[model samples]
Target: MNEEDLSVLDTVDILDSPLDAIELSEPDSATSPPDPEEMLLLLEHPESTQRIVAARAFCELKDERAIPHLINLLQDVCPLTRVSAAYALGRNPSPVALAPLISLLQQDWNGYVRKGVVWALGNSQDTLALKPLIKALKTDISAVRLWSASSIVQIAQLEYESVVSAIPPLIEALRRDAIAPVRSNCAWAVGQLCRELPLNVVYATAIDALIEALAEDQDLGVKEDAKLALLRVGDPRGLKMIEELEQEGWI
Candidate 1:
């Protein structure tokens, strides 16, 4: 299976199963948590691979109690360790870790770290992270921006109100941002926001942005995104602008 499939496998049967026997020789109930030392051993191994292995171990175990220690590893010099820590902590999201993860989402520059943060945010399903994730949707990197958009869609589906407010910012970004990746996120976010709050006011506001984007935006991705957003709003002016761009061979 793929890496994603493996992560799924790592997560399977965690919550429902009896926890691993503390001593492995004696038996405890399914809910009996694993020994902290055992988890520490994995993380403290000399090799970075071993640390990643340990991180995955915690993730598969689905122990919400281990979030803090895993988060501390986010700054590890090893990229694999840092990303693994993020994945592990995300899978085991707890109240204590929520704020820290949101901050990490805002500050992390590493693409893999950002990817892990977005995935964790989706797993946590925290409405509080909506604004930060929306901000991340403006990241210059395509991978980071796309993952942020995907996270917003997931969060919006689960809890719409907190994320619904993201629409106006997204529309504004789509209209004016020079970065193609960020503009694409703005377009996708606009679609997701529309699902939650289909206010005519929003469509009207977004139509103007899309019209300007189609007329003046230089990037193909942003221009195409503007076209798609315009189609959604049924803006005749946007359609005319798109046709003009096509005629000019700019699209």
Candidate 2:
């Protein structure tokens, strides 16, 4: 339609109905198109709401085109926005997203942001993330440590031998971490790793942890994970321990 004819229809429609009644369709190209300039501007917006919304919009756009702007947003003063930016970058998982995420994993003050970095690292599946992820597994926050453990699992899934090299640390983590989830993940990753490594490397330590978890952990799921890990690792001695616990009426 001609602009004048469209204008006439717009005027008539406005006259006939309230603005809320007019179904204004969003521009088709506006849905997920990259807008680096707008994203950059939003990064400096005084309102966290605008900054977070813009960061989320950029993520939903899935534009490698916005990598630079998104990277800059990784340091946003608002923890919420920084986390949103981290997540957006993670979802993109471009090479451009890698350096910034690694940097964030090292230095970001928020555990949530670091968790996002863990996810980004897993998405990239870069072996370079191994040491950093291992270090992050020691983070005080349960959420951060959980992702770090999962990233280790992801790496294990790819480089089974290299992951076996991670076994001592994983065993130590299960041996020591205070968090139930971290210990639980440590148990699970060890079970998966045992399938790939010489069973001797993981069998004793993992079986001990799983047996303890099955018997002593307060969370039933954690106990169940321990049971399952024992099954996967398949130690006859571990089963004997469970039977001993049952005989003692400890189960």
Candidate 3:
């Protein structure tokens, strides 16, 4: 073939190449974050993966306008979509999302979905979530109980009185929960609940419970957590117990 004909053929061959084999140039400016409206539309897409991506975009945008749409996704048929929506709502930090998240935590059948709701409640730091989270601490699922205890601690850190009612439930979990981590978390939560209160103002019942856990809990981790909780609450008993445990090499 003549040189001109060969050059023309090469160009034609390049044009015929499969699209997937070509590398596209990056845009001059970084691709703009998905528009909130576009993200909302994605949430309604039939594909669960699309909905999850949309939910995650909403989380990153942290736009209050997307809160209502994200809340609706909490009930999406796909568990992953529900989880992402719960997470977006939590990170969005709107009081409007609080009740919906609590509802999901209580009603969602999937442990993964409930786990997301528990985390969302903790991130929200809303006092309104206190009662629901306390109830969650007693749930049959260990993952639920673990997250519930952590959420209670988060609430307690933000506002101790809001979680005061949780103290009894926490004590119950510490003493009676079947899971060792749940008991350990409850101990940590009890310490957090009373961390800011004066020694004399602390709940005697809660303090006594921590002392008992320190002395008698079978899980070494639980005892260690209880010991820290007692010390945080200014209980002398915890110090004495720690010293004794150290002497016995139980610490």
Candidate number with the higher TM-score (2 or 3)? 3
Q: Per-prediction TM-score, please?
A: 0.63, 0.70, 0.78
Give one digit per residue, the lDDT tens place, for model 3 in 16-107. Answer: 21211111223236578668878878878888899888887766666777788888899898877888788777668788888888888878
For 122-195, candidate 2 gives per-residue lDDT tens digits of 76777777778888776535666666777787776677666756677777777677666677788788777766
Residue runs of model 2 more than 4 Å from their true location after superposition: 1-48, 58-61, 198-221, 233-248
Better of 1 and 2 by lDDT: 2
Candidate 2 — number of clashing residue pairs? 0
lDDT score, residue 222, model 2? 67
Where does candidate 3 have its weakest 10-residue lDDT segment? 15-24
Ranking by lDDT: 3, 2, 1
Compared with the true structure, model 2 gives a TM-score of 0.70
